[model samples]
Target: MGDASRPRFMGAALAGEAGSSRPSLESGHHSYPSFDNNSSVYALNPEHGGTESRTGSQYFNYRDDPNDVPMQPLGDSRYLDEKRATYAAPRQRSRAKMILAGVAAGVIALIIIVVVAVYFGVVKKNDNDKSTNNDSASKPSGTSGSGGKGSSSNLVVTGGDGSKVTTDNGTTFTYQNSFGGYWYWDPNDPFNNGAKAQSWTPALNETFNWGVDKIYGVNLGGWLVTEPFIVPSLYEKYPKAVDEWTLSEAMAADTANGGLSQLEDHYKTFITEEDFAQIAGAGLNFVRIPLPYWAIETRGDEPYLAKVCWTYFLKAIRWARKYGIRINLDLHSLPGSQNEWNHSGRMNDVNFLNGPMGIANAQRSLDYIRIIAEFISQDQYKDVVVMFGITNEPEEAIFGLDNLQRYYLQAYNNVRLASGIGEGKGPMISYHDAFLPLTQWAGFMSGADRIMLDDHPYICFGGQSAAPISSYATTPCKTWGANMNTSMSAFGMTAAGEFSNAVTDCGKWLNGVGLGARYDGTFAGSTAVGDCDTWTNWPAWDDTMKSGIKQFALASMDALQNWFFWTWKIGNSTETGKVESPAWSYQLGLQNGWMPTDPRQAAGVCGNTAPWDPPLAPSATGGSGAGQIPASVSNSLHWPPTTISNVGGGATDLPTYTPTGAVPTLSAETFSSASGTGTINAGNGWANSKDTAGAMVAIATCSYLDPWVGQGIAPPSPLCSGGARRRDVPLPLITPPPSPS
Candidate 1:
């Protein structure tokens, strides 16, 4: 029997030889033909000069010997004996030769089959790469008026038209750009700023004239920066966990479920390239990304995952760049909570510019701001990241307005130093309203570079009322529109950073985890307005409900001419398995037919209410007077204010960090193309290497208080105080300019 381990073809060939005729050996001299002759062994017919046309059946015809010699009858005993004697020896040799030939033929056949498969596989791969390149070439880099060089021809389009692209870490996602937008990357020149976000928006290479170009934007909330209302599952897992700070602690103790590393999974999965593409397809141009300070680095036993989100942040930038979406990078949470809110990393203490450790926290915040400014100012990112929100919703009531302004001035100056003093040199510095009136900041910084005031106007959180949704449709038009229009002319460039559709606080965990909503009277001291089921149940919403929400959304769009919707998406509750706060999500609104298909349709929603037309100031449009600040104004708003509100004595009495000369600079994140041999290497995150100042570090001799929990405590000793500039120099109070008559 043939060896079972041998090739199947060899076994089959050997089996065919079983009953075949055998060559006979004549007396004394062996007459068996030699198998070594190639023509005699393999030729179909040696009679016709080793070439003959044979039928299918004739091809398998076999003869024991090449000569076609006949076998003698077995009746002759002498002849039979002679035949048996010679046949035994010659037959054994012939059988061995046939086995070797069959094995050789089987090997050659396998080689041919393997060669064919490999050749076709390589050809198919090349064809796919070529097709991808062709698809990329079909996309337009910019609009007709955009006078910029288009993207490089060699760039292979890995994404566009909902095509799938795998990231370097093997994370696969569909790039959902149905709009006439494309991702532009030229490896030869990484800083080529010539890609458009959409056909309606200006190309990255062109100037974005604020007020002239409408910002149809959406906020990427609850991503990078964790929020209980947005992602309930993360908080619901641990019953005791209230916010990210507590969540991190709880998750750390439970190592069975990946421990603190689970956050990295959330970072990877929560929002992806597809989301950015969807935003673009929805006719949105700008994305406001709320990032936490821990994304840069964590300090002093902080339980947060440090620098992990930075990888995703970089990915966000690339995805935004690909989809032609501009970014307004907002520093959502600071070292200590910016506001004593859960979204600010911690829930209770307003240590940032508020308590005993306020000054120290602000110092660390400034260093981070400077570090970020240096990174974004680089040519690689300046075009994409146009606005930098220095802070997100600081409680001005708790942290005095004067202290906040001083900090803002310091941050502004540091950013200017890191970047240069000129238009387009860096991002426009954005400051939140700090929950204060926009009018209060009318002329706060009259002539101090390119600055913008951001306000978050939301009717949902302003106590509950059982009013019909249609009744509130015109509220935004009458109130928000007028306020924003007035502020634009008064404050140069003002934008509603966040606004949502929900007229009442109704969603699960909308207030916070375990903290119920005011709509159903679950919140403390809040009166019940109506049943929350109607608001939270999106599937049950009727046409009338959708119409009211749509009108309200349109009015809001018109009101906040330059605005970013509160959030682009809202995650579903693990318990419910559906989006509880459907009204707040711009994505859900679009999917449900509540949001306008084209945002421009909202332009004249409020009849006769024209949008604010900005004045022709060089500084406003990043022109000649872009970063020019009046000397008087510059001198008045000095860093390290004369005194902090809660801290005793002067600013010198506040706890602070000493510069350790160890700046943690953010490096670039890179990606390889899925279809071709191309790579996008975002340059080292630092824009200006010369502006390197030592990072802030706690002094060893000083006893520092906990920034998060130790609010309202006495300031540390004098040894703990430093990093303040000219403590003896007392600056004049900042008097706000009168509102427009």
Candidate 2:
């Protein structure tokens, strides 16, 4: 765990640049003890190392692809310039002081009148003058339509066919559940004025047969109802503000006038029917849209927040119907962000689980869920894929089995009673595990009516470390400390109330050494193609392209065909895989350890480097970073405009990549390579570009999502403790690349 294990310098493959100050994998280090081939439990732990990714999350990473994205390079530094564009209020005298001036009553009245006039002037001036000022401010970074400045309100991801989101290699992707999905098509678009554009079915398939194809869904943050607060002006600085400001207090006088428009724009941009359609088409049948507790609570006396969410819910249901995408309403944030910052929206820099403030937030969250389930379920969208997440990744009881069970019990009852989802519509909920014994813990918190055991197996920061998949059975250090299935059996976790986990992003883990491959099964993996480091440059096509995706097809057929792999991909924010862990191949920023490849940097690109030894590599395998990406390259793509500011440490270290409104493109060389013999085959996991007969088809990922389970906050079904005890399916020998013809 010492910094010595990591190199003092980084082995970055800059396009043409020379050496720089990077840490090493084997510098002044505590040499890692060799792993006993017989499984003596590898000891390279991430918890006690030089880790930068903070406890919850301190820095926000930005990237192009939605995989384990390297910390986003400080993109453009101009982000801060778009600060709260507040209006300087017109100078006014204090009413108290003026009244006590010992003047005639009429004089006092005159003073009051003058003060009123000045106040009005400030308000009016802010409204009227904003046009010119805002125009310039909004236009500063371009992406504007008119020469005049554009409103930040209108700058959301618009409704258009963004199908070409990827045309290149994934150097990276995280969070922010957009409860704001499926709202793009104007129920009254001039294009479909009288078509009843908003009509859709809300009936969810409630036939609860265990092990049936249960509807699946994920949450996207919908800040539409909350974006007004996006203007930092509305929020007190998180964590350290002397006093927090409420919505009304922040927008009380001047900002309130345009609040409605701001709110509308926020919702408008949060979701689009087209986005839903894209997801639906991707095979995703359901969607869990998470709305925040704040959304329901209004600042004024009109505090019934339930009605507002219902208003939004129906709108969402109609849109999903249009796209054939089902919907499940998920409550992501409590009063604060839940399950780390990934999408909960609260700054992910701190532990929100048991923090005093986090608890109060949890209660408010329960209050909000009860409100939503109470009204929405009784209406038309009853069958909609709706459910309640008692809390997203509540970890207070993670270390304590009893606490975990008790907390969930409270969650179960709270949601059930409040939503009136009585008995059957058991909600699906997940809990984060303590770094302790997952198997032993799994049994302690078993569930009943529709309870699901959600486990987030992380390997990046102080999360779970990776051992051979087989270790799940033979190791005490791994999941439940025993066989995975056996543990699940004990906790009553069987089919139906199955388990799920977000695994390593595609290329984040293929660090094998001693082979070369390409999209066309070319002999590219040959050492002639350079060492392991050169492998990182494996054209995206060459990866699965080898032998026409026999391996990908084999793996997918093997993996997806089974009941595991909850979420297929992870952006940088998931923090589950080991990329920067010195306790890993090397440490922070991959300073030392050989540069074989950062699987996280390139998701699924398999690196044929030597065995990945802890605390650094034994030798400099040429395959170092061969097919994976480096932080330097990763520091490029800036997607959400905010990525610009996330980099550059606020300004001084800003980036130079000007994200031309142009969608980033992939090279034809990268695109044209193919391993398939022009056939469509899902069996091989390689789909065809054009749905031809023999080749498998490439489908949009979200196309697989569904949203039709109408369960109330369900209890955790019989627990599977931690999947630690699950039996590790043995890795079958890969068919050897056929001998040379």
Candidate 3:
């Protein structure tokens, strides 16, 4: 094992990248000794001229020249390589034999070192690279990747058989037994509404069972309940010291500045039975109606709040029933303020159902919920009103989850008691995910009850990195579709309560500071805003991007139990607004041909499972109504009109209920485009043109829509028919487009 007596040889061997080299036994410098095939016996050759012989177990020294001397005895001496060995060369022939032996030993040692260096430095390094590539595959950029936004747990993927596959992020998936069954409409189920029922059951010979059908719905936002983004004109019309605090402030201001009569007119015309009919005719079957708690209960001094909405609210229900559309009654804005958001009817305070005054507000909310639940549970509406949401988007981070959960239970129990229809037999209760991971609520309302997990998946808001117009539409949806089934398995039901086809943040009024419009021409192919200041000269939404978005939308329709676009209509605006709000309008999408004409058609297009396709479709004009109307409009106002000074309800000075007055008659130019189903100019102006379909529809005008602009590239000319026109054009029979091939 010792090399102290061995001779050293020299050959060409270089250091590797790791700086590894062979060490010579004699001189300080090390090299590989050369091997020769001619000699059989081995001789040890020193760097200096000398020879040493190896026989049996001993080393011998012999001399060929006269001056050569015998070598010192081989022993275990601790001499460093810098110290020279005390030996001289015996002869040239003996030296040659020593070189051959040294070369053979060096060659063997070099092979072993090279192999080890290659294994760790090259092969092992490649293995590490493979691990990194896997990580990027699972966690997409800008997504939590573990599951959803704000999620801490890794996703789990289970193979169909008994195998398990965990992602690099530690998400786990377990194999679930396939149910191999589908839901059929049961006449006995009270909540079935009989709309989707078939006259005869399928024959037992039928082989395929239908999967869960996707629900296509739209939120009637800014209609029954208003949001600043939906109608920024309200904010601009009624200016407050702090700008706008809540709906209460806006209501009081609108009553004072523009008179309660004008506000009433807005409520009457903003959305009507016509809107419901139009929605159904377009192929959507459901509408989520968001309402403020104040809509039902009158605060003592707030004259503007719910002064006349009780009547309109019932009218909405009647319209939905008539149109054969189911309603998801969402109590959007609760008492006090829920989680300090503007949509909660106020901003910057977590009062309603959350903080110091949370319990009191929560009790008040529960009281109203009980009333609404009992009302909707009445025989007439029990079937039409299929879902009741306790609240919308409560901020649980600021308000602890424990408090929210407690409130939910209290509200749930109250609803169940008031409803008298126990859990699954009645309408499904809906609860927002409170921005938690979708999987976090699995088995949430467990046991006997049925409930839906409402998640609002939007990509337009916040500071997410801006993507191409099409990327904004396609990327997020594709990611969601990939994991939808597993994430939704635990809930009784689930729905995307609110989503939009918007791909930009351009409506400056939406967030309260920017140019009037974000994109100038259209949204179909518009890119990210290049200059924050420049507002015009953008590309019109084109066919390719529209097609891409439609494909993504169809995929999303298959992913969730149901989905409601954020809004059905954004009122057309004249001042600092357009006659169409592309980001927020479903009608505009349909008219423009970007939105699918029918959502049910998706099941057929995707080749998954059939949707809830009814044989004889439900009627769009015949259904029972909520029997009673409000007793007194003035009494409900609680505050007197601008002419009177009374603070509280006073019987003697109350104003009798008069009609909300004629709809505001404003002059608007006709909307038509070579690119769109040209604006249908009935004598009643552009109002009657909503039903008309086009490749790019833009007709109505209010605070949302642009006015008098000729459809294609420029504004209408001076000679363009102006002013309030009567219904001259025949009403077009608006029909849903044929299903995609």
Candidate 4:
């Protein structure tokens, strides 16, 4: 909508050299020679011995004396003999002196020639050596310049400490840290934007050892994926717009007000490079970006803008690289709503896994996952986007565990197939606990690839209580700490994906549009305890309240150990002119003295709680057992399970899309500086080109009920049903290559 004709850079296979590896010093005690600056030997220009000068006048000066004797007169007769003797002596002396002078001149000429010859010989040898090195360094690796796994040889170190690197374009940026951290980017490679989330985090080129490195993170919520509570101004403009779906519809209807095209302005302005810089400045290392599936591509009937958000998503990645932050790319919404929440693009029905089109919806989801995996699994991106959250919060209660796990297994298999199975091969597949207890998923897919368990623990949604805010300071530690520790040992790597300082859900639109907060009982089925003014009006909050909130935040950080606070910020509501959800905003808290300036301050807040210290399993760290899910387990959770609860007949009876060969890959926005722009190959959006599976498309002769709202509808025909054939079974287990020594 906004200058669609603008040159949007797409990835291509280009030639580029791999980056040079840093030189490592051997470990040992060593001593260096000390120099004295005042010593003459070290002086830039030292005094040399003076050379003696010889003149013909000094060798033969005879008659210049004033006091000459007169005896020369008596030598008329004897003088003839004296004169002959004198002349003979002078001639012999002159001849000997001339011989000595000629010999000295010849010796000096010989010395000069030998010195010049030796100096040039050494210089030529050194030049030859340098030429050889440059030739090897400049040779391009057989990989795409963008998003390829290869490093760029064109990288030249421009900083004293080797932190600054400049590519062929002359664009220079710093990477590597005092800790063993570094960034890996070849402007030629989009998948390899060299970034290290923190000084302690690994660069895109390095392996990320989960459970070993902690995650001090915040979620970039309501940015790419819009939320009513997070960005209320957008909704306030259209009173009838309750969620993104309706908001899009309302905006589309009003052509005079810039219409739906106005969304491009929001995407560009909502979050900028400054926000990413501030996040890093606040000492946060990782960010969880919740993205909608529409960012990739949308169908003809869908009202949401298609592929516009993808441009912004690419911008987000580049920004993260600039600020040294890692990304957790979360797929928040799917074809049908994964959860019946407004954040999932709609708020009406749980059609993703609990409706007549559930199987069909899931099939679309798998295809999307596969597409994304192929893109991220590219060598360039694997380092920065370390983790991939396949889904946000699916309502497991509505869709049985078996139905959900089947989808999870298929999604995992698809991702592994695209990216391969290993720690650095692709992003760690993250799964949300679906609001279920952690114990319920303790040993899920025990031997499968790198899987991380994500849980969102919040006390705010439990309704208001008479308890004071100060009393909840230690609540997180008491409740979630031990459980998370156990989950790590029992389930594998576990993280509290979302948590906040709010003890009461009192923010505007926190529940939903027009639905008031539960704190004042405006929400259905809740009793009022106190007025909303106290919680919503953050400006009036006293020091005591701020202290309590700070303590609560610290406790949550300590409890979760590895977590991303619900959000980095809460946008100002157009109607309220302030952030109603103050507690949820990490940026707001930090500015007002509620959130910690440095997240590390939360380390010991829980008091002597021995943190989870168990050694990670081989598979957990992308070692030997990676992607080794047992055949029995994989078969049990096969794609398109034989039956589903909501479908009137077998799951195969559900309508599904055919796999056409049309795939949409994400492209990046290129920047031009005084130096030339660096090119990044975004790739073909397919990770495994060997995988020639077609794109998921609507069947030509079939009709589908509204995928979002169609529930309990019987299949119109058997041909409408579609699913994986026996040939679509899970691929064989692949053992990843050993880690570098």
Candidate 5:
């Protein structure tokens, strides 16, 4: 009976009272359906956590043979033809509070009323300030590496394949920025007084009816950026850690650093399955996981980090499945300095796909995908997960388009031919942008059916064009985190990878939206620029955007795209507003992009208008196969909800658009006949049955969508024709993945 409210950071504090159904560590992410026949592919991430990070190449849990799909642990090997339903990660927990059980059978009904009141009171307190606060634009005055000051003692993390840690008892543990690893920071003002930690709740959003095709779909990063380690037993019981033991720093920190642990505390936890489950029930679908290649390939024959980290990963996956959420596997860092940092786990040059390490990494990525596909693809979740992304955000200089294309294409082929794919195989691919020219996307790689193009959009390059809510449907080009219209061809998710209101708005403009990329395409430095002569304040609603949320909601629903806001949360950064402008980018996320719950904030995004109730999200797809894109055509990927939908009616349901928290949910449709003009999926994004014929072109990347579709809460028109225009340059007549390869 808890009243609904606005979106928030991991509702870690919501764990006090919860449901009784104890979820399996694996079941914490998503509950899978029954599957008997299959081979290899151990469908769980825990086994990998145990093997990838602890054991070595020869240490997987599963075995060869498709028949082993259902029982396979996590290892390298193949299997033959086999059939099964599918598998999904279980639901992880959240931070929301729970209702007390049976106050009194006689007063049970009355207790329900009291529970509702209490829920609102707690939620209101958290949301009130959040709902209506900000006035002037405020710059971030952060805490710097001063946080990393040397402590009186050192904490050693051992056991569970180094999954164990020894804290200085309760001594002052200091973690400098260097401890976490080097990343980009403005030099002049390179220190602050604010570090951030997160309260991770497993994804429980209702996103079954849709998914992603282009990399623009919503996804959060930094998973492997830094690891947090704390009370293991608590996390061991976390519903999110279902089968595998994935590691995250956000869940293991204290409140001082905004609940963040020093970088050295790395991957430990004290969470419960109940905590993760609440998260799943709350509605945050999809967890963009960034794992270091070392967890599974460091010593090849002796992968040391897996036993623990990989195991955690499995636990997370299962919980996500139980909650019916999707997972986006991202190799955030590479063997060598993929982007000049320690995030990839080391600060060296690791040629992921073109060197000895490349082979190792490729095999690591491939084998991982193979295991997952073989094990879970046949189960009930076969159609839910989209693809296994090759790497996170890599520079074209290191991971060149041609080379990347070659490497990924090779990987894709391996996946297709590996077996256990049955008649329906999702896809395996990779993504990169900001470094390559947007105009040159067509010139990149293409071969796999799930060839997804990713780009990072930041506003550092230009001026901020102000427009009204209605203007969002047409004006404000599609470039990442700048002013935009929902219907414009330039505002799609895939067209403009990630966005952050981080630098630009501080907690200012982004009480809602995010930021990103450039004009000619290719990576440039951060898009941090000077702000207009406007006053900004604390983390309250930006005057313009607060009311604008409704407008933003309308546009995203119209398009249906998914996106990972720039960040989920950020650690303490001594350097604040240090960007030199015209080349700055703010990290998206309050701590990572979730904020505190406030009464007022909750009122606007929650209550009756909110869609977090049970049956909140229903299946929207209806087996007409998937939609299609023009054959042998290379479409120029860009931003804007309307633009993508118009150009390609392909996975129009793909979550290529951005996430708008307060919109109404959609339903699905079952097609009895393929002979109608336009179909109405009774609910969700299903192919409107009762259709006779109206063109069913198949988009090569079958997994992607219109970009807008995934972001929409309600059903949308595949074509919003708000601003259709002529192409300025020639587009690639790109071809789809080779049949079956």
Candidate 6:
């Protein structure tokens, strides 16, 4: 068996070795009687990833068999009605008896007071200051324009209706800074070895063309994603959290248990505007934002479950645009767990592909994509969002290729239609390989012009995790070089969607338990050997390793059309040290001087892949076209000479057309329970019972005093107090009810 301590690719031998039955991909659907229909809204016990206890030496797949929910037949109005009824309708206070009604009224009154106080004293007062700061922070970046460069002040915001408005009035921005300071594009530095006196514009900022530009990017992991291993401190603080799904549930419980204010504060501070500035400064031109389906909302649960994160998602998009960075919006998790991994927001289920529920779940997943596509299609974000990744790291071994392909086709059409592809303005659609052989997708989306494949090739997991650090770093480039050379031939345009230098599998820190160092004593045991900084040979060995790996990274840039490093940053509380930080963190790698300080280095590799092949033009068979040097136009200007270098040779030409499309205006509650119907049902079951008397009182108590609870403010005496005995009180007064008569 492979090292159980690392990530084992399940599609390879594990299914058969474990004697797990393979359900027919083209067969009848089975109803899962034992499945918990209410699991989506309620917290299940923490025994996810199955009952098989994990040993330290075990290679961890982080997948468990899905608990299949019974699927309702489509167009069955009765079943739909029943499901709708199951959604816990907010109980009307008037429906209760007079005694309960009076109590509810009091609770409502108290809630208003608290909200008024907080809104005025906290939210309102700070809102303006935060807004001002955010605007000022975002404004220092350049304006969007063509030519070697344009003044940030001169850029104008063109309205969707083609009306122009200058940003000087504090209306909108049109440009952001391009590469000019670093050695790659710097015209001033004496030590500069590369091209200067030129401008470089990102291909993503132009039209949606895969032919001329190769994608060079980085993943924004652990920012929106609450991965236990990546942000170990979060998990360590909550003992029951085995994964993101579990952690979310625990946080929900904490909020319900009178910790709402703390939860709100957490979301406010987790990932701020500064992170975006730093990402832009690092010279990475793109970011892959891995977000869960719940970032919008999952109607069946408490608000905290969804957590009002849509605002943050929008904030991230704006920030990316402000900094001249493109975004690849990735739906990392689906309604029903797409894969059994914790990153899927559920660890025990591949519900997306299981039995009858699979179709329903697939439809739900499509709804999320459509909504996001609609948002990106708007005038402001159309070009900024370069790729709309449908899903991330799905396991086809359980989901089945037929189902995956079917959903991809449906989803592709939906996105194109919603984003108005006919107008020549839509982002590229990216789909994950799902552990299947890449050859299977040869000419998969041939009819579609801007579809691509997403593959995650990591050295820190599976069999590679056990390999020596040098072999881990140097050997993969051979496969990458060969694969990148043929990417267009095999799949339209392929990219390494998620990858990192980590070469170890230490996860004990997630549980707040310390495991002995996996490498030399100075490095964190959880860090991969490839990223470790404590070599016995000291600085010389460090320099050699960095150089070798840097070359390898450049080789990868040459091989693959585009690549995003696995992560930008891990939580500070979770980072062991600069060198021993989460090995996948690109920021830590930069701090340690292992990563390139300039984005132009990627262009350098694009210009020539020496060890692999002399710069050969892409094959004529594929849609690969020689890059065009951008010509000066009214809105468009010439980018620096070093931005894109044509491999295989051709005349310099710039793509003139900038893709534009209409942003969708969706109805309210786009994914809310009230709007849910047809195949887009929220989930299988809802709250089956009405609110109990205790539940009603508790709800009132929470609605009024939960914030106070989080703020350490005790509710007045008996009723609002945690675990305090409730006194039988008459309506409208705090005095005890006639001694309970």
Residue-by-residue lDDT tens digits, candidate 5, 248-345: 33234334643323322334332222223323222333445565554433332321243244444555444344333456666564543243223443
TM-score, one value per model: 0.74, 0.37, 0.51, 0.73, 0.39, 0.55
lDDT tens digits, residues 1-741, model 2?
A: 111111101111000111111111111211122211111122233222211121242211100011121222222121122123466864455686775554566677777875554334422232333344311112111122211122232222112223122111331111111222221221111011011111121112212222223233334432322321122222222212111122323333335466323444435544544455544433344565655554555322321132344345555665564443544455544543432232333322222323222222333344455445443333223334344444544433211233334445545544445333223432343333322223444444222334443333222111122332222221111221122223233442221111221111112222111111211122222112122222222232242323222222222211111122112111121232222111111111122222111111211222212111122111111113211323342233211111111112221111111111111111100111022223211011111112111101111111211111111212123212333121112222233211111
Summing lDDT over every window of 10 consecutive residues in candidate 1, give the lowest-scoring window.
Answer: 6-15
Q: If ranked by lDDT, best first, what sequence of candidates would result?
A: 1, 4, 6, 3, 5, 2
Ranking by TM-score: 1, 4, 6, 3, 5, 2
The list of candidate 5 runs beyond 4 A from truth reads 1-220, 227-266, 270-283, 300-307, 337-342, 347-350, 353-386, 418-422, 426-451, 460-477, 480-497, 503-560, 571-741
Candidate 3 per-residue C-alpha lDDT over 1-741 given as tens digits, one digit per residue, 9 for 90 to 100: 111111111111111112122111121222223221101011111222322222233221111111221222322121222233475743333576778877777788777765554334433332343235321112211212111233222212111223242322345433221211111111111121212111111111111111233356898887756655566566456544111233445555554555445556677778866576557556576789887776655443433355356557666654554334667889887765564445665544445433223333554566567656655654445556768888987755444455566567656655655444232323567898765546656655454244567877643332222344444332332234423444444444567888665443445344331222223322222334443222111136577766755765654565443688878877654465653345567876777776777564444232323222221111100112211113342133222111111112221221111111121111222223222323422122111222122111111220111211111222123211333221112233343321111
Candidate 1 runs further than 4 Å off: 1-155, 158-179, 185-192, 671-681, 717-741
List per-candidate RMSD values in Å.
34.1, 29.5, 36.6, 29.1, 27.5, 26.3
What would you estimate as the lDDT of candidate 2?
Answer: 0.27
The local distance difference test score of model 6 is: 0.45
Q: What's model 1's lDDT at 688? A: 63
Encode model 6's per-residue lDDT on 1-741: one tens digit a residue.
111111212222122212132211111121111111111101122333422222333222222222232323321221111122244644555654676767878789877875565345432332333234321112111121111232222222111112222221245322222343111111111111111111233322233235344455788776576665566666666776655655666766685544434434545566665565556566566789887777655544423356345556766664565445678989887865665555766554455634323433554566567666665654445556768899887766554565566677767766765554433445678888775445557766554536778877543222212333444332333334445445555565677787665443333332112322333322232333342333222234466677655654554454454678877876554444222344566776677676777645644342332322322223211124311212222113211111111111110111111111121222211121111221221111111111011100221331122210111132233323353222222122222111100
Let me know the TM-score candidate 6 reaches against the reference structure.
0.55
On lDDT, the leading prediction is 1
Write the residue-wise lDDT of candidate 4 on 56-108 in tens digits: 21111000111111222211221011122232322333576678877777689
lDDT of 1 by residue, 1-741 (tens): 111111100000100122221111110111222221111112222332221112232222111112221222311121111122233432233477678887787789777865554334322332333234421212221211111134333334333455565554657766555555555433333344445666567766556778778888999898888887788888778887777888999999999999999999888888988788778878789999999998888877899999889889888887777666889999988988776567788775568876677777888999889888888886667777889999988766556677788899889988888778764478888999765556668877766567888977665553356666777665665446666766777777888788888776788777666657667877655567689998889899899999988988887787688899988988888888988888889999899888987776676666533455556356655667677677776677777766665566766666667665367778776544333445645556666656645667666556678777545567655543344432223232332211111
The alpha-carbon deviation from the true structure for residue 496 of candidate 6, after best TM-score superposition, in angstroms, is 1.2
Worst 10 residues of 2 by lDDT: 664-673
Error of 3 at 422 (Å): 4.2
